[model samples]
Target: MKKNKMSFETSFWTGLAEGNPFREVDAFFAFAYLDYYKQNLSEMVIYSRKTKVYKQDNPSDVFVLYTAFNFFLKVCYGLQKKSKKWKVKDSLCCETVFHLTSLTQEEYENPFIVFQKAFGENTLEEFELFLCQIVELSLSPHAGDPDAELTTPYIHLIKMLDAGELIRERGVEKIRKTDQMDPVA
Candidate 1:
């Protein structure tokens, strides 16, 4: 939740130059999630401005950013699905999974494709585990003081999933039966 003054553009450029784009994108997402948790409009505005500048200055980087963001969302969706207390909307989760699967089929793939290859038939399970690792990382002491009431985006997300708060009202279906006269009678 702390304001991240580090320049995302610089980090991305450095990572790109060093041939380590994945790490940079992942780090950016972590910071973005922290900002989101804080709900700090000013910080978010600054972040957005910087991203826009970066995207304009370097168009190819947009695809890298898109892939990274989609991967993050896919992981989040997986976590939501795996939670016993909560379930992501079937359509939404299915669509994300489908997209990720398609990406894995491509020759030049997102970094998550490595997970798909490694997990084979149990890819979904592996993805959920990967997301669990992220949750654990977010909960680490260096991230913040766990006892603090203020929740980071990662904490809020985990709490929501565990609490089943994401489930829709229609998640539980009701069935009704009424007696009727037999037509053959």
Candidate 2:
């Protein structure tokens, strides 16, 4: 008899409500919002940019998710520097350095894993889930202009995305039409 290994979705995240977007992990995980969540990616992006739109949210432990996924290779040092430059807190800087040293200098860990363990992020799975939350906020009509959206995390995610440092590090060859409007660009 073969026993199946439980996934984080079925494990770490439990007691999901019916019709929850997370039930279709691919929607967020594979960027298949259209198929799974009935969401249009471009619309979501557009919705996210409208920072003034307000949303009425019901109280619930679970928050919906949508994500713009990007990660840099071997970026722990950059995280460290960010802490020093006051882009992030000092504790986060120390944590980044700690993970950098312990994961790379000592264990020779994989670059991808190292970034996940660094100060600002969690394990790869948790981080991916976090990205989904970003996507969720971007899709809401309430996400109109600043201080409008019902969700909070997406606001921070938008600010981070606006920074474009990661996008720059990823070395994008083509900028999206939506991105052309970036204040920094």
Candidate 3:
């Protein structure tokens, strides 16, 4: 008998549909996007200099952005899974995040418009800041454990997304700063 291996995409879709709490889909997408970006870092640097024209020429950038949006969807799913004690407003926020994930790439390209249509401008701004913070943490040097080198970034990303404030408040930032300032004695 032969065993079949499930592809990452298949597993991802299945996890989404099944509402699996441990799948860590956001982490997977984040790591994938980061790997892709690292591979094309030079191109991105060049493209940054020509932002207006870059979008017109670089289709992959759009795909990468869409991938990031997918991560956001996964984050919402995780939030929903863990929202058992959440207030009505928190539940509604989770629903809004999940709904935003349904928007097409064309729709998400103008995120302000989509957000305004679904949530409000304040939510849009906050969401954007959240994404920016996630990306900043993803690119940091000590985002993951040294023993699990390949999965370090993904681990950090998953923790950040799951906890929401892990990157901002008493999470990775605090740990990293403390580790830097004081030696483990």
Candidate 4:
């Protein structure tokens, strides 16, 4: 007999829908999307004398950004089909912090569990740190282009997390609090 421990997806999305993307187990994915959802990485970088949004600095940023994008796309796809199972395009999939990244399908119908196993490496701390690094980098004045699609939300989420203000919690409590309250009418 096996017992099921709550998964990062459940925990992360619970916090996200509630408004907190920086919760304990969900911080990594939260931070990952902190920048990813801001813009599409599939586009090539345009150089400008004014700012270096995609200046050739390190490859890791691209890696994490793509990973974040994949995560988002997977979720969106899952919801559209009413199934959490999703198939990631190979170009956007990544397995580790040291690889070129690859695409893959959710083997267990559980995206977060697969994500945890693929990148978690059984280290929540590492995931948290990775998230922090992405968040800090995203905050840089010269990080991604301010006009880029991903910049605004990414920055906004980072600001909220850095301030230690957890987003609204999504769960029975929220429903209970909302429904149990008297109507204004």
The residue-by-residue lDDT of candidate 1 on 11-120, one tens digit each, is 33224322222333344344445334323322222333232232244445444433343344344333332333322233334234333322323311222233333334
Q: Pick the candidate with the highest TM-score.
A: 3
| Number of the top-ranking candidate, with lDDT as the measure | 3
Winner by TM-score between candidate 4 and candidate 2: 4
* CA lDDT for candidate 1: 0.33
Q: Give a tens-digit lDDT track for model 2, residues 65-101.
A: 3222322111222333332222211121223443332
lDDT of 3 at 143: 39
RMSD for each of the candidates: 18.4, 18.1, 19.5, 16.7
Q: How are the candidates ranked when ordered by lDDT, highest leading?
A: 3, 4, 1, 2
Candidate 3 per-residue lDDT, tens place, 108-169, comes to: 23222232232322343344443444333333333322232223232223333333322112
Root-mean-square deviation of Cα positions for candidate 4 versus the true structure, in angstroms: 16.7
Residues 1-185, model 4: lDDT tens digits: 89533322433333433222223324434464423433423222222112344425764565555444334433322222322332222323434532312213333122233433323232334433434444434434354444444333333223322221111121111112235678789
Better of 3 and 4 by TM-score: 3
Better of 1 and 3 by lDDT: 3
